[model samples]
Target: FKNAGFYRTVRKNNQPNNNFKIEVIQGGLFSDEEIKKHPGIRHETTQETGIKHLDGTISMARNEPGTASTEFFICIGNQPELDFGGKRNADGQGFAAFGKVIKGMDVVRKIQQLPDENQYLKEPVRIISMNIR
Candidate 1:
């Protein structure tokens, strides 16, 4: 992963509205390329998943309809505008909701309360490791 960090609680006009996300680099960090060398998975919004951007919901981040890499986010509030047919983006194809926080919502809220500037955490919360048990 090229980047893995929590989003700032404050929102900027030009920033993508999200709570936290881990950016997965397509190519290794050493290569000086912005996009991936090989074509990655292009998940198009064929149909609505019927998932809403409610609090604690986890979803994939994508610029276009498809082209979702390993980047993802966790919502801290009821972001209904991020749903399909919502006006968050011009395309109207909102992010893909895949999961939610089943426990430890207090930790997520604490992370969201961190200090930040321009949607970037002033003192980033380091994640040593994430164990999925």
Candidate 2:
């Protein structure tokens, strides 16, 4: 629900052509222990829901397959590798995709561009509030 960190744009080797390169952009959420400690928090993984990680998709962040707590991430690009059976993780369960950005993608991109050292944002962005409609 808030900006915890951002993934720096890095050049990855093109699989088809070793000499070619592609940029991969990614980002992460700010975890709040207070939120995680809330009595209402659910530590379970819930159903798979068969969702895929497309651009702007919001998904729960987990260390293992079923350990997602309050952390989450928003896809800055089509991250099929983060979807179920994705290659991004060894377990291959992938992150739980739940929501998509309806607007303000520019703001998201701007935040993604913030300076980062070793993949950690130099200045972590904060979420003052969140509302559900």
Candidate 3:
């Protein structure tokens, strides 16, 4: 997902009950066409890992247990609420955190500042290439 387009970017929580304030830039599930073209692939949700979704952290986005595949998000700030038992999801089974940004956080914040409508970016900021080390 190094070059995937960001689909969702939110500053805070406005949803009822699910008000676990968070800032994130989610990508991987682009558009309907993209979904149709590359149907969402499912893989086992790896658990028991004690990774936390801190600022610049990268984690998989899922609906439920074992529902994550390609969808992932970058936490704009320390998002402990996205860890195990987080209230953002009804299941409280937070996302599967895997990695983090070692540099270029300024770019991540810039992406967070991009105009968004109801949590979705008006115009996605896509990376042409990303180096992972």
lDDT (CA) per prediction: 0.58, 0.58, 0.75
Off by over 4 Å in 1: 1-3, 10-40, 44-47, 131-133
**Residue-wise lDDT of candidate 2 within 1-133, one digit each (tens)?**
4543444432342233333222333444444564455333232221347566777777776677546656667777777777666666677667777778788778777876666665555766666554445
**TM-score-based ranking, best first?**
3, 2, 1
Q: lDDT per residue, candidate 3, 80-127, as tens digits? A: 888877777777777888889888889888888888777888887776
Q: Among these predicted structures, which one has the highest TM-score?
A: 3
Q: Tell me how many clashing residue pairs each candidate has.
A: 0, 1, 0
Model 1 residue pairs with clashes: none
Model 3 clash tally?
0
Stronger candidate by TM-score (2 vs 3): 3
Residue pairs with backbone overlap in model 2: 4-30
Per-model TM-score, in order, reads 0.68, 0.69, 0.81
Q: Any runs in candidate 3 off by more than 4 Å, and if so which?
A: 13-17, 32-47
lDDT (0-100) at residue 131 of candidate 2? 46
* RMSD to the hidden true structure, all candidates: 6.0, 5.5, 2.8
